[model samples]
Structures are given as C-alpha cells and as structure tokens.
Target: MAALKILGKSSSINVRKVLWTCAEIGLDFDLTEFGSGTPNSVTTPEFLILNPNAMVPVIQYEGQVLWESNTICRYLAARHQRTDLLPQDPMARAQVEKWMDWQATELNNAWRYAFMALVRHSPAHRDTAAIEHSVREWNRHMSIADLQLQRTGAYLVGDQFTLADIVLGLSLNRWRASPIAHANLPALQTYFDLLCKRSGYTQYGANGIA
Candidate 1:
C-alpha cells in the first residue's frame, strides 16, 4: 500500500487519532509537523492551502486531501475494510458515529476551557469561574461515558471495539493526565485498562500527551 501523506504534529490529540487508526489498520503514513512554532507551521500559506482551517491533521491520499480527525479515521477504516474498527451494519455504524460525534462536539467542548487553562496554561482561558464550569461539565459528560461502559462491560458500543473507542479513549487519556479531579468511575477505569492492552492504544492514544 502507498503511504499516506499526513500533515500534523504527533503531539496533537487530533493527529494521534489518525495515527492510532493507521496503526490499528496497519496502514503506513508519513507525517509532516504543521503545528505552531514549527518550521512548517499551520499558519503558513502552504499549509493553509491543504487545510484552510489551519488544522493540524490534513491527510493526502491518492491525490485526495481530507481534514477533520474523526472523518479521517473513519475514512481510513472504511478504505481498509476494517469492519472490526468500523462495522458495516447501519445501526452499529450509527452507534459508533454517535459517540465519535459526541467526542468531537460535546466532550471536546466541555473539556476545552479547563484543559486550556490547566494544561496548556493559555492566558485567554484563565478565568476561574469559567474553568470551574468547564471542569463540572467535563466530569458530567464522562459520567455518561461511564454509564455506557457499565452497560457494555467492555467497549463503548458493546463488546466490539469500534471507532467510538478510539476517539473517546484519547479524550479519556487527556482527562486522566490533566490535574482535575475525576469522578468515581470503575467501569470507565476498566475500559481504559482494556484499551491499554492494545498496542495501538499504547503507541498513540496513551503516549502521555494529555
């Protein structure tokens, strides 16, 4: 298989999502660092041509350019026919996509403020009230994940691991690595432990970049 040309820094969670997916699929890729302060920064005109949004993860495959981390992951899985990662059944696919979308929209939104403030130390995100609110919402959303894990007793969408776990697992990694207090979630912890057994998870998802 031809190696994919990926534009992103490995430290980026978004980029790591693609890396983990590729590892799981045994797909080969060459990554160019397009993060802030790098020589090939995302702000550069050349980088913007590939991804107008200036996002870190833009994939070039067979003359096609694709952005959005979750979309890239799904596309790779579908392209490789990895039904174990992304099922063909409509309902199962929808279930996996639902959580992937939640991770991108709801879960990401909930954690951004606190994560920026506490982890990135972004001056713009230092408001104490905002950080507290963000932490509360983040934990609440994770509790919902815990409930789902309790129901499945394994992966997000039942016993089978899917794309949902890839996205959510990284989010969970970020949450754990952050200094914030986590809710009492035994099932979620078990799920994390299970994911740890996967080489792809250890390689990309849990590489301590939180």
Candidate 2:
C-alpha cells in the first residue's frame, strides 16, 4: 500500500459514507480529523485550494484528490471492481446514478433536519413543533424510500449493493438514532439494519457527531 489519506472526521455521515465505501472495496486508509475547525480541511491552505468549500471528506489516493461523498464512493468502488456496488453496464450505472441523485436531492435534506434536531439541538432545547414538521418531511421521504425498496430487490437500485446503498445507508443511521418513529415500514427497517451489520458502517456511521 502506498499510503492512502482520507481527510475527514469519523463523526460525519457524509465522510462515513466514503469510509464505508472504502471498506467495501477492501481499501486501507489513513483518515485524519479535518473540518469543523479541527485544523482539518478548513485550515490547510492546500486542501482549501482543492476544495474551496472546505468540506469534511477529501480523499487523496495515489495522485487523485477526490471530494464529494457520492463521487468518492464511485471512484473508490470502481477501482476495486466492486461494480456490483456500482454496476458496470452503462445503463445500470445510470440507474444507480439516478438513485444517487435521489439521495442527494431528496434524502440529504431530510437527514440534515434529523441531525440538527437530534444531534445538534438538545432534547429539552429541541422545538417539538419544528421537530414534527421535520419528522413529517422525513417520514414522507422515507416512505417513498420504503416503497422503492419494496419495488426493487433489496438494495436501493439493483439486486446488489451500489453507491446508492452506501450513500443512503449512511443517512439511515441518523434516521434510526434520532427520535423519528419507524412505523409499518419493515422493508426500510430491514435495509437499515442490514447496513448496520456491515463492520464499516457499524463502526463509522453508528454515531455521528453532528
């Protein structure tokens, strides 16, 4: 191994998705604490030059500098022939990307509400009304996910795990840990539990710092 570096803290769900992707590809990594003003990505001038946003996850493998959680998973998974997790056929890959877009556009916003309400805000300080609104949004989004899963095989897109699963699976961590109630959605619960069973996801995504 020629020393692969991952710039992000384990407490981040976005970063955790990349971590799980790396683990899925059997790639070893050296993750450093960055972002959230921990002298991570934000402090380093070179990293800032690469990612102006100073996001948590910025991976350096060999000579490639990769940012964004979903893209990182794509690059990492494709490298190790884990196309089952990413798919090889162009159309299949596109379908996988569609689900990834669904995750980014729809699921990401819902997860942020859960994160802010449950992790960032204390229980007493939490606004019940806001929480309900957030929960309703999340519930609607998750219901769509459950219905999607019910229509598909087991994972998000295809018969096997893909970048979509890793991306959305990480989000499910926050959904389960938060006070959101899971009712009559056995399919989604099963998928969530399955993601937890993976050692990488269990170790990284289980407890998000924010």
Candidate 1 at 94: error in angstroms? Answer: 0.4
Best by TM-score: 1
Q: Tens digits of per-residue lDDT for model 1 on 1-210?
A: 567999898889999999999988888889888888677878878878988998879999988999999999999999999999899999889999999999999999999999999999999998999999999999999999999999888999999988899999999999999999888888888999999999999999888789
lDDT by candidate, in order shown: 0.93, 0.77
Which candidate ranks first by lDDT, i.e. highest?
A: 1
Candidate 2 per-residue lDDT over residues 1-210, each given as its tens digit: 477788887777888888888787788889888877576547567878768887868888888787888888888878778878888999999989998888888877765655676767756537777777777778788888899888884888756777888777766666776766754677888887777777877777665532
Which portions of model 1 show Cα errors greater than 4 Å? none
How accurate locally is residue 135 in candidate 2, as Cα lDDT from 0 to 100? 79
Residue 28 CA displacement from its true place in model 2, Å: 0.9
* TM-score of every model versus the real structure: 0.98, 0.87
Which pairs, if any, clash in model 2? 34-40, 83-87, 85-162
